[model samples]
Target: MRFALVGTGLMAQEHIRNLALMPGNIVAALVDPEPASLAWARRSLAESFGPATAEIPDFADVPSMLAAVEADAVIVASPNFTHHDVLLLLLATDLHILCEKPLCATIADAEDVVARSGGRRGIFWVGMEYRFMPPVTRFIEDVHAGQVGTLHRLALHEHRFPFLPKVGDWNRFNRNTGGTMVEKCCHFFDLMRAIVRAEPVSVFCSGAADVNHRDERYDGQVPDIIDNSFTIVDFDNGVRAMLDLCMFAEGSEEQESLVAIGDRAKLEVGIPSGIKTLSPRVPLGAPKAVTREHVAVGDDVLAAGHHHGATYFQLRAFLDAAEGRAPVQVAARDGLIAVAMGAAAEISAREKRVVGMREIRA
Candidate 1:
């Protein structure tokens, strides 16, 4: 499949690498407003794919690229704020889309896209690649298989270094990236919804910009994004999920830890490393037998980079869906809900109150 990839930043580089590895997929066009990013993309593509890269075209913007390129699909990896416009333009064409998460910076924009996109012929796939992460996929499968019977609670924790600087530092502000939760935690939110198989009804969040990027100024503007947050989500199905995020922690064996508790069993999984554990049947009596099992993901998906090897599988699924061989695993509604969760969490944290998901939904 020929693809016009929007944005040539770090994430785009990963997509470029993965696209190159695919047998018939080719990046036909690169789109970005910044000359430096476009130039970097050209060099990176040339370095990665050698002389064949010359056949690919680079554009200063999406509209011009869309006009010039004939592609089977477009991958929208542009900044969060630009997703709405970029996607609207691409939706006019007959190309499938694999859009990055947080479909739009705001729920209003998301609603606009959803409304305008009604009955569109293209396969609009949201890029919630965490759903394809090997360990995460396995964990969800196990939960659905009744390994963790009747899940009641889930906790997802992330302890990592501060946000990595983006191509233009656009991610440092909520206006551009839709807050830290939307920018970073959307993956976890999407995961929570997927694993629990329920819609979040309300969120209570506590967050502060206590560290990371506070002392730094970009274009004379101090970053306002919160570096840490704890969010509690109440799902419609009576499942509860909590997210704990810390951007100041250092030297961790794993970047994320997830625990799911059910009526009959409990499950724990660590990110990147893909170490998983399951404890079946807590002792109700002193003589009751209980068992614990540890499972390690055998594949080294992380070696390929980008979300611990899930990108490849995600792209493959997109390709399969586009080819009519499979259904889209991550739908546009999934992306909207993830964004709503984040936006509501941001509001809840800022206002020191619980925010309903309906408050963000247009």
Candidate 2:
């Protein structure tokens, strides 16, 4: 399948690398506004893929690329704030799309994109790659297989260093990247939605720009994005999720940890490692069972360079769905919900109150 890639930044580079790994899939066109970035992408592609990359075309804008290229689909890896406009433009072409997370910067934009993309022939897949990670996928499977029956609560915690500097530092501002929660936590939010198997009804969040990137200034403007946040999401089916994020905590043994507690069992999955399970005994005075399972994610996936080997799987799944070889896994609604959850969390934190999903949707 022929594809057109939007943006030529770091994320786009990762997508390009994965695209190179896919058989018969070619990047027909590259779209970027900056000439220097486009040239750099061309050089980078040639360096990475050798002579075959020479045949790829470059365009300054999406319209020209859409008008000239005969691509089977488009991969939208552009900036977060530009997602709405880029997606709307791409949807008009009736080609399948694989967009990066936080589908849009705000709820209204997400709603608009979701509305417009509906009933279209193209498959709209979002880059919520965490769901495809080997360990994560296995954990979810175990949950559905009754290992964890009727999940009551789930907590996703991230203790990592401050945000990496982007190509343009657009991520440091809320107006550009839709705040830190939407920009960084959408992956976890999407996973929470899938694990709980329900819609998020309300959210209560508390966060602040306590540290990291505070002393930095761009164009005389200090970064306004929060460095730490604690969010609580109440699902409609009585399942609750909590997200604890601390960007200032660096050099942690595990970058992320997820814990799910249900009536049947309690499971803990450590990022970049394996899963641990503990189940209560049914009979009175019976001993509980403990188990630990390690996961081998494969070196090929690791080389793909995003989300610990999930990006390759995500792209492969997207290509298969686009070609009608497989069902679409992550729909536009899923992406919208993730973005909405982030937006609602931001609102909740700002207002110091519980924000209902209805308010976000409205």
Q: For all the candidates, what are their Cα RMSDs to the real structure?
A: 1.9, 1.7
The window of 10 residues in a row where model 1 has the poorest summed lDDT is: 292-301
Please, what are the lDDT tens digits per residue for candidate 2 over residues 142-260?
Answer: 88777877789999999999989877888999999889889899998999998988999999999989989878989999999989999999999999999999998888877788888
Which residue pairs come into collision in candidate 2? none
Q: Evaluate residue 329 in candidate 1 and report its C-alpha lDDT on the 0 to 100 scale.
A: 88
Q: What lDDT is reached at residue 281 by model 1?
A: 77
lDDT of each: 0.85, 0.86
lDDT score for residue 177 of model 2: 85
Best by TM-score: 2
As for model 2, its CA RMSD to the true structure in angstroms is 1.7
Listed per model in order, the count of residue pairs whose N, CA or C atoms clash below 3 Å is 0, 0
lDDT for 19 (candidate 1) = 74
What is the TM-score of each predicted model, taking all chains together? 0.95, 0.95
